[model samples]
Target: MSAPETATPTIPDYAGDPNAVLNDTNAVWRHGGPPNYSNTRKNWEIAASFKSFLTDWRTVDPNKYTFVMNGGEPQSAEHMLRSNFYSPLNNDFESSHKTFKRMMPTFAWEVLEVYSGPPKVAFKWRHWGVMKNDYVGYNDKKQKVRVKAHGGPIDIQGVTVATVNGALKVEKLETWFDPLSMFKQVSKDNEVFIDEDSA
Candidate 1:
């Protein structure tokens, strides 16, 4: 008996503009290795790396606005904390805003890139400060946002990939922002976690 023909899988079609925003090319290097990183050194190294990324992002495409995060919206870490999303104390809000908007931007927030993982899970709608700073609550007190990230093997062919809990709510830079549809689209595209072992 002849073996049945195996159908090649095509990338799942996401229902929106892949170019409409929410993305990047890649980062300089991957984060890993036992001897390569120590806790203190890793933190410092990552901070330095991120700073470098911000510098590059600013000059990358000057002809076009370099929006930082998914969909490249003009919003910043400061705007997010102060906005109705998370209610920070007015003074804290202003201070945080200044930190992200002014101080951070001074480092050229333009070149900042999202650290890679599952594109969908990694490409969230939240502001940069929320992701980078301490926004998520901790042991009953406020703390950094606790997001779950998985790594490795993935087939780059498809779009309907991964799932991020609050991804949809991220603002879009297009004609309109539809968090629900965008989330759905990403989910269907398989944009989330691609098992690093799946090569």
Candidate 2:
């Protein structure tokens, strides 16, 4: 029999709002084949929709939901933005968002596969976006770093392990990915922008 055809992935538009998109948004891998695939799709969509950036994608209980990124210590969603967004960039939430926004305008994400299910879920994912502009960031040393745009995609992969409450609302979320890999990509030239204020 001929191989079943798979539909091409269409990422979420976010329409300037997804906080959002490799986001192939299709991470779910389509449906109608297996029950597990459906479950996997549900979990992936739950993650993409309930992200801390903007639960705007889906309505989540204020008291029941929070997206926390774990590096060393767990922190609130807003705090995650303020923390080392890219390890080298140690700026406030707003500043970090602005810097990263300019770096990857269409940073998309998708699910690779699901390892387990229910209350506790584990999965692999991929995020990629084209570098349309330069990347500006602050290192832990409080130094300014700028990398010219390579006009290529800064692709990243990571794993998220989360626990859901009775309602399937993620109560605790944690993700692990190499932020330095992204840094190494944009910093291939090792170009550094001096801190003029220090002069």
Candidate 3:
């Protein structure tokens, strides 16, 4: 008798959008490394698509997700969602809308590359955004301050790692970026003045 035929392994199609599979809770994300920036249009499209995928956070499980920056301490999904994602956009303390909306129009990302396997996906990308107004946040001294960009664009490179389970839900996500470079760009373009003492 001929040897038994084995089933062919099937690859999951990302449907021209990696975020489609990533939105599910079984997926996990981790940072691969820093990305390389380029001014090409193709790269910009990739970055924009990936950014769209990240806008939704309802599918991520807080207990299973984690984000790390520059090899520093890993932050939980809940913490990242509240502090980095949510707080920046809608701080109750701030009288006016800050960060996200202000930078939305100029915000862009260039996806340099993507690597994928079952239950795992990685994106290397460059992010760009211009400061339209003063970006209010805590300074190095933990004091409240406003950072201005003077209408200049700020660019940085980063990587995002993601993992998925059989259910195709995103379980974890980690992102990496250079804090110093981001700060330097903002400070270089506009003056940073103290707003108030950290409460």
Candidate 4:
């Protein structure tokens, strides 16, 4: 019998500008915030694009911008990427962003809602992507940690509180989220639970 030709599988194209998707995306506002604060679109845009702005931070005044996670002290983008995306000590800025970008080419972000306004803005945001390729990470020891591609959505959400100067610079930013939840999704067997009593 003659063999039939099989078509190659295609990767889904990532829509919109990868660096500026959050710009066209809106940050929904529901209601109350601190008094004396104006929850305007300008403020929302600032909060929404804060991460992107930080990414191209050569234009950012070092003396004016700061970032933190949860309630911890301020850190640079390098510190944040290394700590949050992959191994804190293993992957540097280039490798960490590149690794994740390749693994999750369609990563998208949006702000669910804005709770407050500038000078000190508080909002909830989402980071999501599809596993178009294998999820690979480096541990603190620089060993490779990988999970096969599942072609499923991976998501994480969190609240961000930041202070911006009159120039719209994010002076101090803090984000709180359950990182372990996000990590569990990329695990080889997500449902594999350890026996607590045995430990």
User: Model 2: how far is 66 from its true place, Å?
Assistant: 6.3
Candidate 2 runs further than 4 Å off: 1-71, 78-90, 196-199
Residue 163 CA displacement from its true place in model 1, Å: 25
**Per-model TM values vs. the true structure:** 0.20, 0.61, 0.56, 0.63
Over the full model, what C-alpha lDDT does candidate 2 score relative to the true structure? 0.57
Off by over 4 Å in 4: 1-60, 81-85, 188-199
lDDT values for all models: 0.27, 0.57, 0.52, 0.57
lDDT of 1 by residue, 61-145 (tens): 2233222322445542322222211235433543444443332232211112344343243322221111122122121123332
Candidate 4 lDDT, 147-170, residue by residue in tens? 677788889899988786654455
Q: Where in model 1 is the C-alpha error above 4 Å?
A: 1-53, 58-60, 66-199
Worst 10 residues of 2 by lDDT: 30-39
How much is 109 displaced in model 4, in angstroms? 0.8
For candidate 2, lDDT tens digit of each residue in 1-199? Answer: 9999998844333322232321434333223111222212343343332333343323233455555555555544443323222442456655665687688766666879999886678999897778889887776666666778878778888898877654445566678887567766666677656465631
Report RMSD (Å) for each prediction in the order shown: 18.6, 11.7, 9.0, 19.5
Pairs of residues clashing in candidate 4: none
Rank all candidate structures by their TM-score, best first, as comma-separated numbers. 4, 2, 3, 1
- Stronger candidate by lDDT (2 vs 3): 2
How many clashes show up per model?
22, 5, 21, 0
